[model samples]
Target: AQTVTQSQPEMSVQEAETVTLSCTYDTSENNYYLFWYKQPPSRQMILVIRQEAYKQQNATENRFSVNFQKAAKSFSLKISDSQLGDTAMYFCAFRRGGGSNYKLTFGKGTLLTVNP
Candidate 1:
């Protein structure tokens, strides 16, 4: 069984600044995938960025990047040049593909507020 943890329940950041959200997961599987998902007030989950466990280089998508420490099992999300639209509940999820282990285990989530 795997579990995800987000130490920060809430975070506030100013527009154009950067904010890092903490996340650590527990799993014995060597091959897996980490994901950061954002859900705005509309309640739709959007994929922010994803990282493959085997990849040495961290995954980045435009302004969103992840610090993936495979040994520590920590995958944190860093939002650069933050915008008000980035305000939402961010969830850290994990899923190991192949076979029947294809279910997503998500963290409790961190509520991000971007202030102007």
Candidate 2:
């Protein structure tokens, strides 16, 4: 079974700054996908970034980027030039890529508070 661990339950960042959210997972599966999803006040899960285990290059999308350490099973998300709109509950998720049910396992989440 794969489990996602979010060490920081809550985090805050000043507007227009950078913040990195930490995440670690335990899994024996060789091929898989890691993702960072954001849930705002609307409670809608939005994909921020994704990383394929087979890809060495980290995934990045605009202001969002990931630091994926495959050997250590650590995946962290960095938000650059954060904005008030970025305040949300961020979740880390995993899904097996091959011969799997394709069920997404999610972490508890980290609540992000972007200060004005």
Off by over 4 Å in 2: none
> How do the residues 55-87 of candidate 2 rate in per-residue lDDT, one tens digit apiece?
999999999999999999999999999999999
Per-candidate Cα RMSD to the true structure, in Å, reads 0.7, 0.6
lDDT of 1: 0.95
- State, as a TM-score between 0 and 1, how close model 1 is to the true structure: 0.98
Give TM-scores for every candidate, taking all chains together and pairing residue i with residue i.
Answer: 0.98, 0.98
> What's the CA error at residue 91 for candidate 1, in Å?
0.1
lDDT of each: 0.95, 0.96
Prediction 2 global C-alpha lDDT: 0.96
How many clashing residue pairs appear in each of the predictions shown? 0, 0
RMSD of 2: 0.6
Q: What is the lDDT of residue 89 in candidate 1?
A: 100
In angstroms, give how far residue 24 of model 2 lies from its true place: 0.2
- Across 1-116, the per-residue lDDT of candidate 1 in tens digits comes to 88999999999999999999999999988889999999999999999999999999999999999999998999999999999999999999999855685899999999999999
